[model samples]
Target: MDIDRRLKQLEDSIDENVIDVYDSNYLNIPIKLAYYEIDKYSELVRELNRIRYACKTYEEKELLIKDYIKIYLSSRKMYLRILRNLNNGAVKILYPDNLDEDILYRALKNFKKFDRGKPLNENLNTFMKVKLKQNIQDSNQELFKLKHYPAEYINTFKTYIGSKVLRYRNDLVIYKDAFISETEPHIYSVYFNEKTAEDTKNALLNILAYLNGHPSFYFTENYNFNRKLSELYDQFDLLDMLRLRKKFFFESKEYKEPIFLELPVLKQRCVLKIQITK
Candidate 1:
């Protein structure tokens, strides 16, 4: 694994094209390597600057910088490992003769756990899980807590409420660290403390399911689709939150109890709990 070899590959990469890779032909094999760079340095530097500017002492920077270096080195090693696999013919590219076969082959090769493979309760690789978990931990949270959105998103109506709100694939997002409290019984919280977005979404779906299942709990949406939510939340959030399936709790016809001074609906108990399992 010489630097010269990678440089040479870079030169040869110009010839690689999707038209050639996807065409019907004889046994033509295309070996492509796209490096996925894992970057933590910028975030680390930001932490360092924050600590240097504000922290009473700069002793924290040493430990944090050291950890960042370790992570950077580990990322380099993984890239090398992936390269080694490609060099050793362990990782396969597309065959113009049979394009889909290699995809199945690669999936079978990378298969680790038997998962349902849905986004809700979706699985992440070890490194990806670690990366995501690091982000959550770095947000100055303990192992777990019922999270709340930042004070900026202070709308009583439809809104996303998560410390780390990820609008990953679509409009609807995972919410946390937020509760509108009128009474203990009338508290609907957007809460999260999960390792993966899938699990968080699964928890959300479960909450939705529970609410939908209860005969006493009637789920109603605002008839007006024209009026959008605040500009604070994304256009997707404003749109998705109003989507009947994603409307967990919002300003509906629930006139009896209100979230704001005179808001219509009562923010019901979202009651998302986080527990650590061995």
Candidate 2:
């Protein structure tokens, strides 16, 4: 199978609005590969066609089709992550108005219908609402706040992006009840792409840098303890690492807990483990 040609064709068909990688049912999983713009979608399709043409049996063609979608989904998510960083403002601006009303309705109205799914439609709406509202209600406030305490925004978005990456799943887990976790867990069990870990880490780093704050802190020579931590690029089990640290917290400032900073040391265990006791 000429995987490269198919990947290129798939990429060539992509467009910002025509086929929203974010909205597509096929591309919603955690993105493992970088997104291809519309120009590149054709390259992916060509490769897919090549694979189909080369397949000796129906099963092989089916396998190739599955692989093609899976890879494209992963790449799309990765692309979304890139946009999450490079175009945070744009994402923030367009999300609310451009939301797919049908999806939103299905998600909200048919909660009982899809038992294990992420309430994807619902989740999408909520994410957009929260992000857009924050951007809208406090555009100036966010700017002022970020300027005053850049780490707050940086830390906030980093956790959100990282958590999104970590929590991506192939199958949806549906529940009738609202979800809650009794245990505070930190985990980084995102499925790894066959692609280089460096690509994923670099994409993350790029997003981290653009999140309304100082990308410089990630490079502090004095904070060598947390600097780069390039080793984390290979650590596919970040979720487990996080869970072991037991220091994970929601990225909300309103929460009365501390979230993990993008520090390298926490990869092993919490360096400053704070215990609350009577």
Candidate 3:
């Protein structure tokens, strides 16, 4: 936690590998202490600036600066804890030498949750979930209403709609075996199904069109890929109402429906309830 010690590590870091500390929570590891090895100095400066901006509402810059310093200090304590608990033999066999602080922090930050023997659900699995969670909570107030609905609905809907739209798209098999959950607040996630992409895409598009009186927001007869969605939505100037999935809905290129419009934002009942295949 000492600033001097962290500053020393940051100055010495110079490699590109992670160091997993198995004995504790992965993310809590102090990363700033090992910043010397982080490759892009520009990125560090950018991040620092962003953090600085976030703290700007405070009248005094001193308080804001202290907050950033605390973040770095806390990160270093974690790094040291990981180093202390590493298996003696595993450390020798895997690393064989001291690592620069930067490499150690980067490696640890990138550490897969699996490294700690946790289940896939415990792991973030992907950044998509993070983005999805943020969008849904920030945008879909109505859909979020369902979260407060009786659990019975959440537990039963997919079977309720299985034969119709929620059925399996890949085979004759139905999503009678599906289930749904919220990985993050407001993000209603059904177990991935054969028709998941289609079901979600259509449901969202239909809702958006119904609300906006547009021709069911579509590509300009040319846009093709999930990455272009923001551009296309912006081109049509629909970005204010559109959002990606795992937050409010799911998104996949294979699924004809790429964006799920948040109907709840208008404070209306959700046009469709999710069906989980069990």
Best-performing candidate as measured by lDDT = 2
Residues 1-278, model 3: lDDT tens digits: 24345545654562212333222433333332222122333344356556544542323323344434443443444334333433221221122233343433345465322234543222322322332233333323323322332121222223211101111232211233333433233323333333236566456445444333222333233335423653454444234233331353444344333444443222234453222211
Candidate 2, residues 208-250, lDDT tens digits: the string is: 3232111212222344444334344334333333344444344
RMSD to true structure for each model, in Å: 19.6, 20.1, 21.5
User: Which ranges of candidate 2 are over 4 A from the true structure?
Assistant: 12-87, 92-107, 111-278
Give me the runs in candidate 1 sitting further than 4 Å from their true place.
Answer: 1-35, 39-56, 93-278
Best by TM-score: 2
Give the per-residue lDDT of model 1 (tens digit) for 168-236.
Answer: 222232344222222123323332222224444346644443333311111125423212322222233
Scored by lDDT, model 2 comes in at 0.36
What 10-residue stretch in candidate 2 is worst by lDDT? 173-182
